[model samples]
Target: MVEGNNSEATKFILLGLIQSPELQALLFGIFLVIYLINVIGNLGLIILIYIISLLHTPMYFFLSNPAFVDLCYTSSVTPNTLVNFLQEVKRIALPACATQLCCFIIFVVCEVYMLSVMTNDRYAAISNPLLYTVIMNRRVCIQMVVSTYLYGFSVGLLQTMLTFHLSFCIINHFCDDIPLVGLACHKTHYKDIKEVILFTLAGFNTLFSLFIILISYIFIVFAILRINSAEGRQKAFSTCASHLTSITIFYGIIIFMYMQPKTRHSLNTDKIASVFYIVVPPRLNPLIYSLRNPEVKNALKRIIEKVFSTVK
Candidate 1:
């Protein structure tokens, strides 16, 4: 419990997911597979979107950024987690912990808003199919994408600055705001401020984005209902199916992890929930999008055929 004049603890030990040696090896293997899938799936989605001209719509344009962000988001945490699983002492320096926290905030915020924007895209396309092109024009899409990343970076910087200023007595679990606050030394003003900042920032980001998603989907549901033909209704819903699945899994886990009272949270449960949000979503999103969306599926088939022909 050492403290300096202006510095918190320089290094904090991370108590990883499990303690048993045998289970550690098994979990390590499982997470390795999960991490690899996350990487390949996300990268494949990005590359597929880029090379396939058919996917060059506002929907896929919005889709690609999440793929990129998920790739980065999982990488920032999962690899370190893998190494820690194998190590005797899973210690992380304050700077590295800060970096992980920064990246986590940046991508989580990006993911939150990106889901909202994608929902809006769906609403625009479904509610006004004739003018979908004009509504989601290239300039407008570009602005939306830029704003998502900008907000993410801004929040990341603000949160990181506030968090690292506090003196931590000890730290365990992965580098996340709630757990970090729990382990921080009981410095009244700094602790209070950090908790408030966490609540405000996380609450606003989640709720604001969720509000947009809710309103957009309500309109989308009505729009689909208005279509006279059953075929027309199905076609409209098919477009949004993948995005909706993504939003469900993502937001469900986020709310479960963060929106609860502190008394209700256990570090072990938080660790498992963290895996679902961080590692699982990246792998699942690509599958959800590619499997459900016809455009992406067709493009993937074309690419596979082309590659096999080239080999022959």
Candidate 2:
């Protein structure tokens, strides 16, 4: 039901992850748990950041953006994926599938830039602590966030336009960009060019964001090394440690999944990669920050105590 001249298919049969009923049942339970945790952890972090004034610094402000993105990003895929595990023919309406792909592009782009912005925030906080407040004022923080969202929206719209032009006579997997391109009924004239453009957009964005992160972290490492006190150095590294871990896991999986040309990509392998890429980051991000970050932990503790006292 895509309102385009190119779309031929009305619905896509999502051959969800695997065909094994037994494995599907098992994966259903596993992913249900993961989705719940992803929801609670991310929403909790967002609410905590909103309510707790102590965490109103530039770091937490940037942190909350990713949490919100993770929540929406996972929601766009996981519920439908979970349902696909229960039924044999996992058919998604063309409109819904198109919406899924658009949302995926939007949030993934937002997340990539959000991570970059966070690194910049960390660089400012550690490299110039005295001027941190001046450097990341409220207006500047809002502008950076607004810019990230705007860029993401633009890319999502552009990519969605390009993708929906394909006449999907047959769809053999989830409504992801890679799988859709791979399984699209490539009888159209622009198929090859479109695929090239799609991959180029993905690859270019990945490298561009990675370049920003790499340069920011390099400056961060030098600034941390210059600190004389061992405690000062540890504190500085600690601030970035959670972000560093999250990025390593995120970028490592993303690079493995998307960097390959479509010919080299095995759908089976890509499906596994998709699970890790989609599920793991949202689940682990909040845990990494909450468990490792003193501020988040203290804020949670205070909120818990207040709730208990009010109940008593």
Candidate 3:
């Protein structure tokens, strides 16, 4: 039975993106721009998808979901981090810290599973083109989405519970207030174990999903190569290029951060990597998908034209 300290620490101060004032200002500006772009781009994608009946296909369907998830993903971290940069003291309460951590974990896990589902969608389109509609129908799509959220939420609950359950007795300083690794102040030997579990879950989900994507692409590439017509091969390759680019960027940063030795787990490094997952990917995903997709571009153009015409 863990005893409660009613007089326990309430809040924690977050060391923003960087400690240097110049760097903080610079980073704040950069991230602000990125956040704006992320929100605009993703929101545009969602709107375009909804308004344009032509983009009701499975690919666009999955793309829009990730765009939404990415928006939430970036929101979970960037806003708070940005605010902390401006404030003299960036303090968060214990409940807020727990909430942030849980939210962050949930969105990230969702992104991972969503990417996997997107890869599978692509695989079906390429490998079983004739039955793509039947295989990835609305029911199936809904199930995939539901499962992704369920898996993410369940994993997040487990991790957050395990992490906060430990007693923070050893450190006299603020344990509850610090976000991320700051929660480790408890004389908990479970830090290593917790990290291992997190790494295992994230790593397994990412690597396994990546493996499926790779295998699917292998088959897809083979199919494309077998196509005698240049146009057919070109179309197939073009369809996959955007997904490949997004996946590479997403997993590249994740693997780089997690696959490293425990010795490399610095707070600054982790924060930077977290920025990649939270800020950069969300900003880039909509651009990548929209720029590559003709239907989306056309819809966006129409929407912009209508907005300008209305203002006039």
Candidate 4:
């Protein structure tokens, strides 16, 4: 992202997904619906969790943060994409693009590690139920959530600033180049530092967070196996079902999308994969919790009934 080496393209035109007008229109409609659903579902769950007195435990407390992160994650990317679907040139102004990239990175990093934090919370609950409350008190939960954000901010800001500062244009562009840094439209210059910084950030963030999540789940699995009662074991597993599903879905898509060697993958596939990866997870997070967890289901029913009674 260094200066003076790249063309002074004030705007980068995204080679939007499909060149066909008809396909573009169809995609526009489809994504618009998905965006709306994502917003409503994630926000609805966060509101419900906060409103329901019965859902005030450490688990729900952690759940609410992820719900909000999901909402923020959706907001960060979906609207701009929806706009791109209908545009003629798919142009994003320089400053606007920088802002979008920053927000996207922040939420993405927060979410990757937040899943591990939740896993640790689950391990404590399953393995040390007697001290779960004390282990995850109000202050501790807030600190954990805050640290996730702070870590996200540091990783995102540094990568954004460093990567964006380096120039990434030219005929022989590296595979791991920045997502929308005018690479398609301009041919400038490049260096080894560019690859180093990008790889370092991506590798460090993914591996560190992944290590924490795997370790926590290992303890969790060992604890679950030791429970003598079959029902107790099932209940413990059920508690982690939602988070595990989220981790599996998101990490599977994202890791495949980002961590691959750029040359082996097609840009078109990358675009489509990223679109689904970003949009689907947020939309599904709440639904997973609501459908799988009895508490969320009960709270939703109770709220609906109370609303109906009021209306009547």
Clashes of 2: 0
Strongest candidate by TM-score: 1
Number of the candidate with higher TM-score, 2 or 4: 2
Give the distance in Å from residue 88's predicted Cα in candidate 4 to where it truly belongs: 1.7
Instruction: Give the per-residue lDDT digits (tens) of candidate 3, residues 209-236.
Output: 7887788788788877887889988888
The sequence of per-residue lDDT tens digits that candidate 4 reaches over residues 1-312 is 323644564655566767788998998899889889988898898889888889999899889888888888778767877887787767665666667777778888889888988998999999999999999999999999999999888877776675566443331211123454425334435435555666677777888888899999898999999999999999999999888899889888877876888676676666667677778898899888889999899889988999999999
Please give, for residues 1-312, the per-residue lDDT of candidate 1 as tens digits: 478776546788887777888999999999999999999999999999998988898989999999999999999888888998999888888889899999998999999999999999999998888999999999999999999999999999889889888777666667887778777777678788888889888888899999999999999999999999999999998888898899999999998988888789876777778878997789899999999988888899999999999999
lDDT tens digits, residue span 1-312, model 2: 233564355777777777899999999999999999999999999999999999999999999999999999899989999988898878898889889889988999999999999999999999899999999999999999999999998888888888888777555556778777776665566878877888788898899999999999999999999999999999999999999999999999889888976668977887788778889999999999999999999999999999999999
Residue 95's C-alpha lDDT in candidate 4? 68
Per-candidate TM-scores read 0.95, 0.94, 0.89, 0.90
**lDDT of candidate 4?**
0.78
Model 3 ranges with Cα > 4 A deviation: 1-7, 166-179, 307-312
Clashes of each: 0, 0, 2, 6
Error of 4 at 80 (Å): 1.6
Q: On a 0 to 1 TM-score scale, where does candidate 4 land against the true structure?
A: 0.90
TM-score-wise, the better of 2 and 3 is 2
RMSD of candidate 4 to the true fold?
Answer: 3.5
Whole-model lDDT values for every prediction: 0.89, 0.88, 0.76, 0.78
